[model samples]
Target: MKYALGPILYYWPKKQVEEFYQLAKASNADVIYMGETVCSKRRMLRNGQWLDLAKEVAQTGKQVVLSTMALIESPSELRNMQALVDNGDFIVEANDFSAIDLAKQAKVPFVCGPSVNIYNGSALKLLVKQGMQRWVMPVELGRDWLIRLLDECSNLGIREQFEVEVFAFGHLPLAYSARCFTAQSEGRTKDECETCCIKYPQGRPIVSQEQQRLFRLNGIQTLSNDCYDLINDQASMGGLVDVLRLSPIGIDTIEHLEAFRQQNDKDRPFPTPDTVNGYWHKLAGIRQSEDEA
Candidate 1:
């Protein structure tokens, strides 16, 4: 299976963002996804900048994909998505339905992002018909459900058309809101709020009353409280997933990528984390536990 470094979710300074990818190019990641995905207002790098970065990454022999914002709140964001699709140099990851429409209209083979809610065989077939060459399993969907979907595709005879990707590392992005929690926490209005998220580069951590990390706050996005360490599950997920995606969190993601590359067990026990996998199991969405394997 190949490895893909998902978009840099946090807002880093422009130079730092460029530097991170430079380091990533030397890493074991096979595919590189770039562009602003979380908050459009956090524009440390502009559309042209991302396109340029895509070109630079492509030079490193990594297939570069430009990603769209998950939540398009304005006309400008829509236009941005259009431009990303229009840019002929690389493929685009359609995060929203509108992005899918634009990519189809452009007649480009696109990747369906996790937020698109693709649930079954029919949906997968329809997406393939609409020009989706690859699909990312929704973050909350588990192995059992994924196996069922894959089996359905096999029975239906359309399994070869799409590559399945899984979010294997980093803090899972749980949900996003229209309201900016970072601003609210700082007693500022969403519109007028200074980009407070800039301070907490990886996002502000949310803790419970007992001082346990319960979640992470990134502007309007809520992430898992425990940093997911899935290096051990790499082998078990080998044949089922085509690409293992590691969403960028901090500067030190190279080690995580390397660990997965060197793993050996196909049904290896998952590495224990002090956070919840509730969202993945269709459970509480915040319950934490260690899988005994």
Candidate 2:
């Protein structure tokens, strides 16, 4: 299966963002997704800069895709989505319904990001008609759900029309809101928050009363406390998934990508801590199955 570097969900400094993509340019990633998928206030790299970066990455023979924001709270954000859809060089990942509409209106092939709720075969078939070339399954759905969906797709004779991608690694994005949780935690309003999400590159962790990590708060997105790891679960995805998406978290992400590329032995022990594979096994998203554990 092809490996895809997903969009950075956290707000990172411009230099760090550029450096990370530099590593990605030389890494084993077959597809690279760039742009802001979270809050719009995190503008360390504007739309023009992201487009430039996409062009640079495309030079390496890797497919580049511009990802749209998951939550569009204003007309300006909608216009930004329109601009991304209008980008003639590369395809765009539509994270919201508005973005999907924009891509459809522009008559360009688009990827349906995980944030878009495409749950059924009918939805997938209709989107194929609208120029959806790829579909990244939602993080909450498990293997069983995918099996059923693909079966339905095969029954409908549209299974070969689009590629299937899964969020294989990184902290699962659970939800998004209008309020910026990072700013709220800093005792500031969303408007005057000063773009403080850049302070926590991996996002601010939220723990329970007993100090157990529960979730991560990144600007407006709520993510799982544990990283969802499926590096060792490739056997389960052999024929089902076309691409495995790995979200960038830190500098070590390049190392993980290399490991994923060279992984031939399925018996190797999982090398990371605070990781969960339960979501792939139809269990609680936060719990790791005994076999995988």
Candidate 3:
């Protein structure tokens, strides 16, 4: 299956962001997604800069996709989404329904991001009619759900029309809110507060009262405390999954990408700790199934 490098969800410095993409250029990633899908205030790299980076990355023969914001709170955000849709060089990932509408109006083929609520075969068929070339399945859904959905799509004769991507690795993005949890944790309001999300590159982990890791707060996005891993499950995904997405979390992300690329080696070590494969096994998202363990 093809491997994709997902966009950086954290608010990183411009230099770090550029350096990370440079590493991606040399990695085994077949597809690369870029752009800020979280809060708009994290402008380390503006739309124009992201487009320029996309152009540069496209030269390496890897498919590049621009991702739209998951939550559009204002008209400015909507305008930005329009600009991404209008980008003629590369396809865009529609994270919100507004983005999908913009892409449809622009008559451009788009990929639906995981944030978009496309739960049924009917929704997938409708999106295909609107120029959706591919879709990243929502993280909460498991393998059984996907198999059934693909079967339904096959029966409807729309399964071959679009590709299927799964969020294979990284901390699961659980929810998004109007308020900036990162800023709130620092006793600052969302507006006046400086972009403090950069301080914690991977997000601030929130633990339960029993001292167990619960979730992570990254600006306005809430993510799972444990990284969701599916490298070992690749054998079962041969025919069902088109692409496996690995989200960029740190400098070591490229290493993990290499591991996923060379997953056939039985001696290769699994890199991240406290990983969860339960979501793929149809169990609680945070739990690691014994068989997978």
Candidate 4:
């Protein structure tokens, strides 16, 4: 399976974001997704900045895709999506339906983001009709369900026309809300509050009373505490998955990606407390069980 570097989900300094992508250009990745898919308030890199980065990365022979915000709460956000669709340089990953419309208007081939809630082959077919070239299955679905869906897609005759991508790594994006938790953490309301998420390079990790990591607080986004690791299943992944997405994290991401690239055994380096794949196995999302590594 091809490896894809997913859009950076955390808030990073402008220089740091630039440097990160520079380093990623040399990494063992085939596809690079650029753009701010999280909060609109986090503008470390604006449209021009992201496009410039995408241009630079594309030079390294990586297929670049511009990703839209998963939470588009304002008209301005819709306009931003329109701008990306109109750019006409790279493929657009439509995270929200508003972006899908924009892609349709632009007559551009688009990748369906995981947040779009495409569950069945019919919905997938509908999106394909709208010019979706690839679709990311939702995070909560598991192996058996995906096999069933793939079987259905085979029967439907349009399966060969679509690529299937999976969010194989990173903290799971559990939920999003109109309320901004980063602001709430600072004793401020979401509306009038200053953008405080800029301070936390990685979203604040919420820990249990016993100091066990529980969840991550990223503006309005809630993510699983454990880093979602799929290196163990890389070979098997090729059969069911077209691309494996490694979500951006603050610490040791390059190292993690390198390890994943070198690993061939499913149980090589055992995953640590900071990593888990319970959600992928259809078990409790936080369960930290593992096979012999």
lDDT winner: 3
- Evaluated against the true structure, the overall lDDT of model 1 is 0.82
- Model 1: per-residue Cα lDDT over 1-293, one tens digit each: 89889998887888889888888878888998999888888888999988887888789898999999999899998988999999988889998899999999999889999878889999989889999989998887777788889999998889998999988777888788899888888889999877888888888897889988878888888887676555655555656889988888866886677767776444555455564555445455455434323
lDDT of 4 by residue, 1-293 (tens): 77788888888888888888888988888888899888887787889888988999999898999999998888898888888998878999999898998898789999999888888988888888999998887877766678889989889887888999888889888888889987898899998667778777667888889999888888888888777786776665656788878888854676677777677545565455557776567667776446423
lDDT of 3 by residue, 110-140 (tens): 9999998889999999999999999999999
lDDT of each: 0.82, 0.91, 0.92, 0.82
- Candidate 2 lDDT for residue 244: 91
Residue runs of model 4 more than 4 Å from their true location after superposition: 207-212, 265-273, 291-293
TM per candidate? 0.92, 0.97, 0.97, 0.93
In model 3, which residue pairs have backbone atoms overlapping below 3 Å? none
**If the candidates were sorted by their TM-score against the true structure, best first, what order would they fall in?**
2, 3, 4, 1
Poorest lDDT segment (10 consecutive residues) of candidate 1: 284-293
TM-score of 2: 0.97
| Candidate 2, 62-172: lDDT as tens digits | 999999999898998888888888989999999988888888888989999999988999999999999999999999998999999999999999999999999988989
Q: TM-score for model 4? A: 0.93
Please give the lDDT score for candidate 4. Answer: 0.82
- Candidates in order: C-alpha RMSD to true structure: 2.3, 1.3, 1.5, 2.1
